[model samples]
Target: MTTEDERMARFARTPAGQRGYDAAEVDAFCERIAAAFQGSTMLTAAQIREHEFAAAAFGHHGYDRDQVDDYLDRACVDLEYARRGDSPHPGPERLSPRDVQRLRFSAPPPGRDGYAAAEVDTFLDVVAATLAHAGPTGLSSQDARAIDFCPAEPGGPSYYADEVDAFLDVVVRTLTEQEQKHTAS
Candidate 1:
C-alpha cells in the first residue's frame, strides 16, 4: 500500500494562472496528519477540519484546493474513528455547539447565484444556540429542513448553496439525534 507521504505527493496542482493553497504549507500540514496517524502527533479531527492554508504566491502553481479539502475531510473522519477504535468507515458525525459556531462556507464567484449570506449566518447562530442548550429553546431538525434563505442579489455577496446545504444535513442529523436522546430520558 502507498504511504501517506506518497499519496500526498501525488496531490494535483492547480491549473496555470489559478491560485490555490500554498504547497509548502499543505505539505507541512500533511506531514502532521501522517504523524497523527502514526500516533506520533496529537492532531485532532477538529484541527484538521478547521485548518487553512495561505494562497500560493503570484506565478506559483499550488495544490488544488478542492482536492486537498476533500482529502482532509476523509482524513478528519478517519482520525476520529481511529481514536474511538471504531471501524475505518464511519457515518457522518454529530457536531457540537462550537463546531456549528465555527462553520463557514465559501462564496460563489462574483455574479454567480447563491444563498444570501446573512440569512444563513443568522440561522447558524440559532442552531448553535440550540445545540449549546442541549435541545431546548431552539429549532428541531424539521424546522431546519424547512428553513430557506433568499437568493443573493446579482453580483452580491453570498455563500455557496451546495456547501450550506451539505452543512445543514449535518446540523439536521445532530439535532435529530439530540431530540431523540432528550425524549428518551
Candidate 2:
C-alpha cells in the first residue's frame, strides 16, 4: 500500500486520527466548516447530513465518516480560537465628560425619512442639556458654523420670495376672496 493508503487505514482504526490528511489539509477543511456554520445557532439534522457528505468527500480513502466528523468537531473549536482576536489585558483609563456626551448622541434617529423637524429640535434640546451640565461638547458646531457663514432664512429675507412665500400669498388671496364674498352678501 502507498503511504497515503497506509495512513488512511491507520486513521480508520484510531479514535482521533484523520488518517490521510496533512496539517495544511486539515486547516483548510476547518476553515470551510467555519464558513458554512457562520451565524448558525445550532446545526439541524439536514445540516448534519450535509456535513456528513462533506466529511466523506474530504476523508482519506477507506476512512469512516464518523472519524472524519470527530476530527472536524475539534478542528472547529480550534478555528473559533483563531477567529477571536488575542485577548486584551486589563488597562487603566480615565472617563471624561466628552465620553459621556459621546454615549448620549451615539444613537441616530430611526426609520426611512429620519427625524421630523420637531424631533430634531427635541434631540438638539437634549444634546444642549447634556452640554450644559458637562460643558461645551461641540454639539452645535455644524449649526453655529452654518449660521455664521449663511445667515439668511429659507425665503432670502423676503415674505414673497419663494415657494413658502408663494404658499403664504395663496393663503392671503383666498382669505381676501372670502372676505369680499362676505361683504357682497
Candidate 3:
C-alpha cells in the first residue's frame, strides 16, 4: 500500500491536488475544530492562522485570494452548523452540481423584467423631456427634416431602424456564439 507521503505526492500531481479528500474525513475534521471554537465571538489573527493550518491539513489548500476566501467561508459555514448541533456530513441533502447548473441557466426573474421596463421608460421619458425643453434648437435641421418626412413606422426608406436593428442583431448573435463556445469547452 502507498504510504501517506506517497499519497500526498500523488494527490499533488492530480488536478484536484490536496483539496479533493473524501468528503467524510474533511467534514469530521471540520466538525471537531468547529466544536472546539464554539461560543467564540471573534477570532484573533493568531486564531485565524491556526485555523488556516488546520484547514490546509484538511485538504482545503489554495494559493489564490478568491480560493482562500471560499475555503474560509466554507469553514465558517461548517462551524455554524456544528455550533447548532447539526450533522457535519455533506450528504445527499446538499444540492447537486446539476441542480446548481440548472439554477444558473434558468430564465431571468420577474423583478429583472420590471427593472428593464423601468429603465426603458426612464430613457424615453428623459429624451422626450429634453426635446420638449429645447423646442427646435436641440434638433439639427437634418433631424427635423427627417422627422417631418420619414414614415411614422420604423421601416420606411427614410428611417434607419433596419440598419440599427441589423447592427444590434449581429452584436447579440456574436455574444451568444461566444457564450456557446465557452460552454462547449
RMSD per prediction, one decimal? 11.9, 27.8, 21.9
Instruction: Report the Cα lDDT for residue 114, model 3.
Output: 14
Candidate that would win on TM-score = 1
Every candidate's lDDT? 0.73, 0.32, 0.32
Clashes of 3: 0
- How well is each residue in 1-185 modelled by candidate 3, as lDDT tens digits? 11121122211211345443343343443344444555434432223223432224444543333333334443443343444455542421232222212211111222221113233233334333433343333323233223221222222122122222222222233334433544677
Per-residue alpha-carbon lDDT of model 1 for 28-147, expressed as tens digits? 888888888778879876667657899999999998987887667656645655676654533334566666665656776454578998899999899889887985567998999898
Colliding pairs, model 3: none
Ranking 1 against 3 by lDDT, winner: 1
The 10 consecutive residues of candidate 1 with the worst lDDT sum are: 1-10
Displacement of the residue 145 alpha carbon in candidate 1, Å: 0.8
Could you tell me which residue pairs clash in candidate 1? none
